[model samples]
Target: MAIEYIEGDLIASGEEVVVHGCNTRGGFDTGFAGVVKKRHPAALDAYMEYHRNGGLVLGSVIWAYDGRLIGNALTQPTYGRAGKHISYAAVEACMQSIDDAARNGVPGTPFSGGFTRVSMPLIGADRGGGDWNEIERIVETTLKSVKTVVYVLPGHRPSADALSSRPRR
Candidate 1:
């Protein structure tokens, strides 16, 4: 299990699966959701369809396959109610996503060959207002035994250093 931090665009990182912090309501209006929706409409549409069909819920992870990019968009409920304070649900969702990948070999198609790598922004930190220390601990502990290589992409705004250097709660 290896974790790498890259300061760049999450979408263009080219990881096997790109994890997205999404709301339980299935609205992709802001944050990573908005970016994914703009770049891959099919992914967003699939997420919405799944949500409408009672598939998306708190702590649930949904994989939307993108034909154009030939990759998978892994969306999980980081925020139960949109525009509200972050909750442990985000951490649960994140852990669940990783566990699912390790056990199920990535949701949706495996992209090129299989699910060996994944890229994602800081779960529940940006819009979800989650504590970085807690989020980091949860992620590290969860993936400690996994074999997949995970790349954590920092947000574009604020700068990677700025976000990481912020005082931890």
Candidate 2:
């Protein structure tokens, strides 16, 4: 898979092929798109750049168990876990972002006039209190139905630490 993983602060990785993670809105000076739109010029530029480069901006929202939509996916970190459970609400939100990008004719999508590559983070599996496996399964299932590239960010744990931490690597 040409799909690559990146791990770092979203701003530091702003130029990433596709930066992925949580709390994107927090990075804004005044916080939130509405506030940034009115106050931060650079924030707007970064957002435009992200859109121009075909980034998938997953908004804040967490889904409930047995929910009908993925619009309420969680974006907070909780405990030792990465995120909350993958809910139908969360997946719907992601898919909607993709659809919006395609419709807007973003850079990466040559066929649909959208970016060819899309980068996103592990959603709904952190503080939102969702299951990792379920989230992975939901994302995988969604990806299987599409022809887009979705590169996920891996844990930022250092290589040496990861190797030493592994059971029998």
Candidate 3:
């Protein structure tokens, strides 16, 4: 199934897993990461502590909450716009992990039987300098079972058939 796109505020979707692509280097201090940091300080603390404890690894993920559910996919070695920082493999791996958590329940989250809806900004795109088409394909391929929503900022228009899950045209 293809990914569904929605133009709205991803940060305010506290009920959905606010997943975003970040580097293994740590610190949610720039771009969309910074927005996440400001909205969910506990996630930032968890990420900071996790980084300090040497949890740096591509394809890894860290889930944390502070009145908000945040999923940090360590899908890049670092962050910069000079070249592509996003790893296609890592993004897929991270999404697979999130798919597991969304299907079988995240170990520490308050809910059980996993999450029903998963939401995120374009994973591995934006500041990571990755291709959106590729990332969208990865998301569609990896997050098949659960309801998924890809949020974009306002002024961007979604497909007329955003509600459909058929393959991308």
Error of 1 at 74 (Å): 9.5
Q: Write the per-residue lDDT of candidate 3 for residues 1-169, one digit (tens) a residue.
A: 5556776788875445778888887657887889988888877887888889998678977888666578888888878767888999999999898888888887767745788788888777778888877888788889877788788877643332443444564
lDDT of 2 by residue, 72-135 (tens): 2223322223443234554555555544553454342233354334444444443345564455
Q: Best candidate per TM-score, number? A: 3
Clashes of each: 0, 28, 0
**Ten contiguous residues minimizing lDDT sum, candidate 2:** 62-71
The TM-scores, one per candidate, come to 0.72, 0.40, 0.88
Full candidate order by TM-score, most accurate first: 3, 1, 2
Q: Model 2 misses residue 86 by how many Å?
A: 6.2
Candidate 3: deviation at residue 94, Å?
A: 0.2
Which stretches of candidate 3 lie above 4 Å from their native place? Answer: 156-169
Give me the runs in candidate 2 sitting further than 4 Å from their true place: 1-4, 14-86, 96-112, 144-169
Positional deviation of residue 158's Cα in model 1 after best superposition, in angstroms? 6.8
Write one digit per residue (lDDT tens) for candidate 1, span 38-107.
8888778777887789866666566666643222233344444445345565565556565556555643
Clashing pairs in 3: none
Clashing pairs in 1: none
